[model samples]
Target: MKLVPLGDRVVLKQVEAEETTASGIVLPGQAQEKPQQAEVIAVGPGGIVNGKEVKMEVEVGNTVIYSKYAGTEVKMDGTDYIIVKQEDILAVIK
Candidate 1:
């Protein structure tokens, strides 16, 4: 499915948390919390800020960290993705 953000919003696919512990031991799904890291699947063209248009600092394929409780869950072609604003994006990972 194609995603076109309306404004300064972004659509992200949730990245799964570690399936194993730091010691290389595998952990069950019940042991993990919802992963807050996400991949930038799509982004808006820009948004209106002040009297000018402010473009998004993010792009597709960027891995970023965002607020855990932010964004809305959406399903596209049976895949889950989150929709959030740029303001909620904390940082971009290397």
Candidate 2:
């Protein structure tokens, strides 16, 4: 099954966290922090939202950084994804 966002929602697949520290010490899975970076999988068409006109600034294949506690988590066919509003996305990684 595939995810198709509606309104101003965006679908993202998070980039895996680093398993090793900069010093080369391998950290266990539990010690790794969830990365805020994610690749844009799908984007909702921009339109009127809450009395304001919204425009989508990101696109598929773009890497973005989102708020730490933003978005809803979903699992499909063993793949994890996050669905969030466009406003929840902080910045696009160039």
Candidate 3:
């Protein structure tokens, strides 16, 4: 099933974390940190939110960095996804 975000929500698929350190040390799965980078999968249409006009600044296929603890985790057909608000997205990778 495809995820369709509503309001100002955005759907993202997280990028894979590096398995090796800069020093070339291979880190185990448990030792790897969750990546803050993700690719935008879907974006909700911008509209009035909390009585304030909101406009979407990201789009599908855009890579973005988000807050470390933001968004809700979801699993669909074995694929993991994050659903976060536009405000939670800190920056869009150029």
The TM-scores of all predictions, comma-separated, are 0.75, 0.79, 0.80
Candidate that scores best on lDDT: 3
**C-alpha RMSD of candidate 2:** 4.9
Residue pairs with clashing backbones, model 3: none
Tens-place lDDT digits, model 3, residues 1-94: 7999999999999877665657432323333333377899999997998888999999999988886465899999999999998998988878
- Model 2, which residues run further than 4 Å from truth? 19-35
Q: Comparing candidate 1 with candidate 2, which one achieves the higher TM-score?
A: 2
Task: Tell how far residue 71 is off in model 2, in angstroms.
Answer: 0.8
How much is the lDDT of residue 80 in candidate 2?
92
* Best-to-worst ranking by lDDT: 3, 2, 1
Task: Give the alpha carbon lDDT tens digit for every residue of 1-94 in model 2.
Answer: 7898988999999877565657432323333333377899999997998878999999999988776465899999999999999998888878
TM-score of 3: 0.80
Cα lDDT for residue 63, candidate 1 = 86
Model 2, TM vs. native: 0.79
Task: Estimate every model's Cα lDDT from 0 to 1.
Answer: 0.78, 0.82, 0.83
User: For model 2, what is the alpha-carbon lDDT of residue 19?
Assistant: 56
| Weakest ten-residue segment in model 2 by summed lDDT | 24-33
